[model samples]
Target: MKLFAVIGDPIVHSKSPRMHNNALQVLMKNAVYTRYHLKDNAKLKEIVNFFNGVNITIPFKEEAFKIADFKDKSVVDIGCANTLLNKNNKIYAYNTDYLGFLKAIDNFCNIKNALILGAGGTARALAFALKIKNIQVTISNRSSNRLKHLSDYECCLYSNLNLHKKFDLVINTTSAGLHDTDLPCNEIILKNIFSNARYAFDVIYGKNTPFLNLAKKYNLKTKDGLDMLLWQGVFAFELFLDCKKTKEIFKAMEIALKLP
Candidate 1:
């Protein structure tokens, strides 16, 4: 059987195995999906050699892109990758996160300006996605150092968020609210940022995160990362099978996620 897995730190909470395994069963593909709890990117080379294809999460997307022999345009643009395929003894990288984010926010609102909270791989993907849609993007992080890599976009320290400038959309790409009640930015900063925002999106799924909750309190349309996860997983599955039957595979994965 061909082997597939998602590699990340603190991966015990990931639902990717269940999501991909169900699609494999429905398609009758001879493959098994699993998880690898890697604490750091140092072991990435060794792990990539062991799996035929892999999905990257959290801190490893940038590392994955660095190690791949080839990268798709999306991965090249974002400087990060979330999907990889091993072919002819070479690893190829792709960034399905961009596609997923685009699909998740489609037709949601007319967002002319967006604020992305965080400067990680996911943030890069989102920034690129928004830029292609002609949406002005401003990225904010706790420190200014991480923002340097994403110099293409307007960036600022969390302490210097442009309160006077109104943002139509605000997105939290950090993991701050994934395991705790912490908000990505200070509550005061968030309050000011959301004052003129029309919608908020948090890239942490399954639970109502504090970021989303705060947006809700402000009467802003809020969305968790569930749809982004589903769509990204679907796109990754297409790469794994190299097939076009995405509609059926998407349905099977959706059912798997909904089941107890």
Candidate 2:
């Protein structure tokens, strides 16, 4: 069987395996999907070469991009990758996260400006996507040091988020709400920002994270990462099978995620 897996540090909670495995069953593809809780970046290339295809998450996307033999234009533009395919012992990288984020936020609201709360690989993907849509983007991270990497966009420290002036959407691209009951920024900061925001999105799924909860308290439309995960897995599955008939596979994966 062709092997595939998603690699990340805190990967135990990932639904990529279940989502892709179900899609494989629907497509009758001879493939298996699993998760690798990878803690060390040094082992990424070794683990990826062992698999036919792999999905990357969190801190490893940039590392994956750096080691790939080839990268899709989107991956190159974003400087990160979330999907990799091994062909003839060479690795090719792609950024399904951009496509997935676009699909997830479709028709949600008229976003004139967006505040992205992180400075990691995912943030890069999101910033790129939002800019493509012509939505003004501002990035905020806990520290100012990482802001330098995102020089194209206006960036600031978490404590200085109010300097942005205005925002229509607020996105939590950090892992602060994952595996813990913590907000990405201080409660007062979030409250001030959400007071005028129309929507809030958290890249951490599978639970009502404190970030989303705070958005709810402010009466903002809230979204989790579940839809993004499903769509990105669908795009990755298409790459894995080299097929385009994704309607059935998409339905199957959606049903699998809804199972009790």
Task: Please provide the root mean square deviation of candidate 2 (C-alpha atoms, Å).
Answer: 1.3
Misplaced by over 4 Å in model 2 are none
Positional deviation of residue 4's Cα in model 2 after best superposition, in angstroms: 0.7
Which structure among the candidates has the greatest TM-score? 1
Full-model lDDT for every candidate: 0.92, 0.90
Off by over 4 Å in 1: none
Candidate whose lDDT is highest: 1
lDDT (10s digit) by residue, model 2, range 1-260: 99999999888878888888888888888989999988999889999999999999977999999999999998988999999999998999999998888888996778999999988999999999999999999999998877888888999998877743768989999988975679888888898898888899998888999999988998999999888888888888889889897788789899999987
TM-scores for all candidates: the values are: 0.98, 0.96
TM-score for predicted model 2 compared with the true structure: 0.96
Ten-residue segment with the worst summed lDDT in candidate 2?
158-167
lDDT of 1 by residue, 146-202 (tens): 898998999999999878899999999998897667999899999988888899999
